[model samples]
Target: MRHVISLLIENESGALSRVSGLFSARGYNIESLTVAPTEDLSMSRMTIVTTGSDDIIEQITKQLNKLVEVVKVVDISEAAHIERELMLVKVRATGKDREEIKRTADIFRAHIIDVTDASYVVELTGNQGKLDAFIGAIDPALILETVRSGVCGIGRGDRVLKV
Candidate 1:
């Protein structure tokens, strides 16, 4: 099964490398990953997407917790949460294609951030499926160059996951 692991770690050099190294050492594939500094610069959040059996996932959690720089580790795949992803897609566009792309972008609520005679860069933020659908619709009309900030999630309602 797929697992979304959210790790809070000390914001220091080599910290991310160490975490990623663990997965590499075990030959586990990371489907997606995103890391950024939190309000407290001393810490950062690493969101990783991977797949494995129940026993392997349990082992992953245990090994991750053993890292001294790790503050917390959470398996959020089963949590009640709201998850989102951000994507930027640059597509080839010309006069008529530009108009069509703009119209389609409006439908997806994606903003055209840059435009040139031959191409356009669009920015979008939404759940993964919505982004995928938006990209799918735009791909046929133009050659697409894509960038995605992986998944990020927070618990639903008033609940918060404990560290």
Candidate 2:
């Protein structure tokens, strides 16, 4: 099973390293990780995506808690949650392809943030599926570059991950 684990940790050097080390030592793999300082700059919130069995997921959470810098760990996947990722895709747009690319971006609710004579930079935000679909919809040869922000999620409704 794939799990989305959210953590509130001290914002200091080595905190992320320690967390990643624990996973490396345990031979668990991180599919995606996104971390940034919270409103309180002294702390950071991290969303980690990993695949494992239920028991392994539990163990990962337990070990994360054992770290001194780790303040809180929540398996957001265990509850109702909203997941989102951002992607900036640059595609070749020239001649007849220009109109098609613009139309496709509009259909996907993506914004053409930048445009040059031969390229368009599109900014999109959605779940992984939507991002993948957008890439799939474009001609592979037209794709110039892609930058992605990994999954960042939070519990839905009234649930919150408070440190």
Candidate 3:
């Protein structure tokens, strides 16, 4: 099964390394990771996406708690949550291809952030599946480059991850 684990940890050097190292040492594969400083400034929120069995997920939670720098860890996947990913794709654009790409971008509600005589850079944000669908809709030969920001997630309603 897939899980979205959120962690509140000290915003200190090596904190990220240690957390990631733990997963690596245990042979757990992290599909995506996003970390950023929180409002407190002294702490950071990290969202990690991984897949494992119930036993494996339980073990992961316990091991994460063992880290001294970790303030709290929650498997947001257990509750109502929201997740998003950002992707930027540069595509070859010329003549009819340019018009078609523009129409596709509009249909996806993506922005044409940059444009030139030979290419167009489209910025898109949505769930992984939505992003994948956009890519699938485009011709492979037209794709020049792609950059994706890993998943970022948060719990819904009054459910907040705090110290």
Candidate 4:
């Protein structure tokens, strides 16, 4: 199953490398990873997305705890949580296609952040499904480029990951 593992780690050089190294050395695959400094400047928060069975996830969590920089680890997917990803798509937008693209973006509630004579850059934020659906709605031939920010997740009410 897919898991969203959040970690609080010391915000220092090589901290991210060590965490990623652990997964690499263990032959585990990380589908997506997002890391940034938290409110506490001394620490950073990392959200990792991966697929594995319950046993595998348990093993990954235990190994993560062993890392010196990893202050705490939690599989937020275990309980109620909220997850979002940001995607930016550049698509051909001219003639009739331009109007169609604008309509499609409005339907998805995405913003046309940038526009030119021949293309537009659409910014969207939502769950993976919603983003994927938007991509599906657009014609592949019209798509110029796409960029997505990996999943960022947090536990629901009362559940939190902290040092």
Query: Which has the higher lDDT value, candidate number 1 or candidate number 2?
Result: 2
Q: Residue pairs in steric clash, candidate 2?
A: none
| TM-score of every model versus the real structure | 0.92, 0.98, 0.97, 0.98
How many pairs of residues collide in each model?
0, 0, 0, 0
Q: What is candidate 1's lDDT per residue for 1-163, written digit by digit as tens?
A: 9888888999999999999999999888798889998877899988888899999899898989999999998888777777899999999998688898999999999999998889999999998899999978875658568999999877678655445
User: Candidates sorted by lDDT, descending order?
Assistant: 3, 2, 4, 1
lDDT of 3 by residue, 37-156 (tens): 999999999999999999999999999999999999999999999999999999999999999999999999999999999999999999999999999999999999999999999999
Please report, in order, the local distance difference test score of every candidate based on alpha carbons.
Answer: 0.87, 0.96, 0.96, 0.95
lDDT per residue for candidate 4 within 1-163, as digits (tens), equals 9999999999999999998998999988799999999999999999999988888899999999999889999999999999999999999998999999999999999999999999999999999999999999999999999999999999999997876
Residue range 1-163, candidate 2, lDDT tens digits: 9999999999999998998999999998899999999999999999999999999999999999999999999999998999999999999999999999999999999999999999999999999999999999999999999999999999999888986
RMSD after CA superposition, every candidate: 1.6, 0.7, 0.8, 0.7
Candidate 2 segments exceeding 4 Å error: none
TM-score of 2: 0.98
lDDT of 1: 0.87
lDDT pick, better of 1 and 4 = 4
Instruction: Tell me the lDDT of model 4 at 40.
Output: 100
Which 10 residues in a row give candidate 3 its minimum summed lDDT? Answer: 27-36
